[model samples]
Target: MDESDGEALAAREWRLIREERWPGPMNMALDEIAAETAAAGGPRTLRVYRWEPSTLSLGYRQDPDTVDWGYCAAEGITVTRRQTGGGGIYHDSHGDISYTIAAPADELPGDLVESYRRLCTPILDAFDRLDVPAAFAETGRPALHDPACYLRELHPAHDVVVPGDDGPRKVSGNAQHRRTDAVVQHGSLTYAVRPERHLAAFADPSVDAATFRERVTGIEDHADVTRTAAVSTVEEALAEWADAAEGSWTEDELARARERANEKYGSDAWTRRRPGDR
Candidate 1:
């Protein structure tokens, strides 16, 4: 083969992992595995997953105490923390889709914000293909110490949003955690609004639920887009953008995720971190 053809063949192709809905701990464990695996020269990946029984995920440095424990206990909501930084998100198995892209850091841009923007090309393309008219947030002003991820003013550069008459309602929220030689970027692509109280009850017991729902948008809100369609759209986008080949996980990656679950994700010592508590 010619040198150029050889280079083309050597280009990294994505391994697709369409994981079934799992617990918050295992979900996060898999993400960590994505990062480490990519750093170790594993194949690039596009992973899709969901949360079962509904779960609430907090930012890396966020205070777990910000959540109203009584509310969660009464409602049976699973509380966990993400490896990436951001506000807390309520992962509804029946309501949303979660996706992540893992590749060598060198494959991505060096700038933090730009890297975030670029990694989303496939998602943006997917939305465009679906005629959803979604784009990145134009302004990413920080939230006023709010624990609710949806409550934060959409970080224009960091999030994907759908424009509407009411405002720019965020459709997806993304964050990044860089490994030595790899990068893992994950986000939630919701299709419908959660029960306002599901998020409000824990984020702030006093906030009205209906108002919170207005701050965000779901794929279903426009064009009645189904999760299945959204997933397919994204998969199409990935294939078009990267020429990625579909594949599955290696035994080593699964083992790493399992080990991470035992030591980090599954442990309250890691998830339940608060200001003074640990």
Candidate 2:
């Protein structure tokens, strides 16, 4: 190996992956690839991606039967599952910025809560740069995990929100999946929220449209933010805060992701698989 090759290999490097085209299955597969690889002594990766035709992404352990398949089918909305645990989310193509940040477990705090907050700084900083008045929620989480991530108000320390007369309105929904080798945290930032649209697919009679509106507020609704602007702001600030060097996926990474998609994420056995199903 060349002398420069040794230097490159020795230095701890951060990688940024921006996904321009990926269906629900491929996206989830890629996130898992990053997590598993990092845990196995690969480079850390931060990913920003978008979904096409929108998608309803279920939490890892969430019962797939919770959603109305007939409604989703008729509406042409696809359903997928995440490697992380949180409430399901509607990734609207028009109004959401999705991101995943993963690193080896040793690089982050052992305390899960502390690590979650640390990863959120980039997003919170992006909000500040956009001049969006933001703060972490000061309230506590629900006693039980809400099926829909947007429905369950996130922990005040981890969720970024804007002030409201009623309370802090959540702008971002985050969740974590801790692996033996890596800690992956990913989330959605809504530029616009059509709660009625999302609720129609995921919420049952237990949740009403009014309640959904009250709990979640879109960035656009709260400010003049657009999807492009939000994404750009995040790309710049998040990369800087995390000290990442923009990069692309390696061939091996893509191959592993595609293999994972075929074996798990795209399969019925996995998408609908409940926790401990194995």
Candidate 3:
């Protein structure tokens, strides 16, 4: 690496947080907290986490009516809203591997696409490390307007896909939420696609498992690695990319995250409200 590259890598103390299981609301809350903390000069953080009880996270502007509330409730799936925009994602604890990267906005590329590429570098590396060839879609696809993220159109810059018999199928869906002081990008990596549960979360009746399977794919489908190994590989790739040191959440941070969870992410006012309502 060049002198400038070394200085850039050392600019912030990167903290690597391994997998932690939490309820849906708390996971979202923690991402917000991490961004705020980084803006306030805390360590830049890269974290891998899982959603307990399998939650359905709606996009910031996504209509709650798109969700099948009755089915979600009966199936014991938690519903929460993400700070970022995109379609809803059914994060199965066993099938989904989620991650987040938070840093001061000024430290990264100002252009949105450029920033996504910079942050997603590690993710692409992780897929390669697992012997699953993956890359960003070379061209954008027409939007399907499906309520589920994986079923939506692919973006050339951020949506990571793996080779398939038909074509490149999306294996990961990523989105960013930029604040005045910091940026947080969180994404879902499909370790194993659960078609039934994924389709059941949406209210649309016409979409079925076959439609979902055609568009979305999983890492396990192309690679022999187990979910646990895949998570570890991703964590390692992120840590190396950031040159991060092992870390854990502080007590005060957790307390603050819990408060935010209850007031925002976990509340019906936030989850059920229509876009532009607040």
Candidate 4:
């Protein structure tokens, strides 16, 4: 192909993949497909979704067995591994919203840390719209390896946090994967916490329920806005952040996710991280 033709093929698209409320496994699978597709040298896309019955997602290199699988299964709490690496997070069905962004590598400037700050602009904007004073952790402190996402605060760009009980606590969790062509980042936005489930699901089970809740505050806690309103606000903020680019998804993307899940996310081998790893 000619240089122009190659560049044309490489140009990314702006789209959104809105999947139905699904289990954790399916959700992770879909993200994999979307990331791969975006890396295939197409347009950038955003995916917004929710979980049914709630769930806990471990980081890709995390040990799935570290979580209370029995408790999760008994309560119908789905657990899955994410394509990005970090820590485990609890998805409250009515309390939090999930978002993933896939775009060409060249679309962003600087290294992974710089890209994280760039993507977080919209989230910071969303918090501003809600009148919440949110800021990114600039000091790159290493996050603790705990089941609770908020316990470990590290600055790898913008891990959203604000002053709250026990001082500043992370209100959102994010992870990123950059390939030769595309970078996909996904994260959890905390709105509510079922303390019991949160504590029980952890393999290391350390944080107290009250302390955990005290540390993490959602939109509802900060303002009069409900979770629904927060989600709507985030959507609008993200739309504006992308300069009015529309978000969308397709059937082909969903198929690709399932295939990737079967091969990567669903495997036990990919769920545990080695020492000194993220």
Predicted structure with the largest lDDT when compared to the true one: 3
TM-score ranking from best to worst?
3, 1, 2, 4
Over 32-95, each residue of candidate 3 has an lDDT whose tens digit, in order, gives: 9999889999999999999998999999999999999999999999999999998899999999
Q: What ranges in model 4 sit over 4 Å off? A: 1-12, 18-20, 138-145, 244-247, 267-278
Model 4, residue 146: displacement in angstroms?
Answer: 2.4
Better of 3 and 4 by lDDT: 3
TM-score of each: 0.89, 0.89, 0.96, 0.84
Tell me the number of clashing residue pairs for each predicted model: 5, 2, 0, 11
lDDT of 2 by residue, 127-205 (tens): 8887878877887545223777776756765677788888767788787888877888888888887877788777473
Model 1 lDDT tens row, 140-198 = 64453377777777776678888777777778888888886888999888777785645
Q: Per-residue alpha-carbon lDDT of model 4 for 1-278, expressed as tens digits?
A: 23553354234356655435877777887766666666776557776789886878886566655788778778787777776666788887887788887777776755777778777767778889989877875454344445456666665474777765346766777778777777778877877656677777777676677777656767667788777778878878776566435655567776776777666655555544443454
How far does residue 8 in candidate 4 sit from its true spot (Å)? Answer: 16
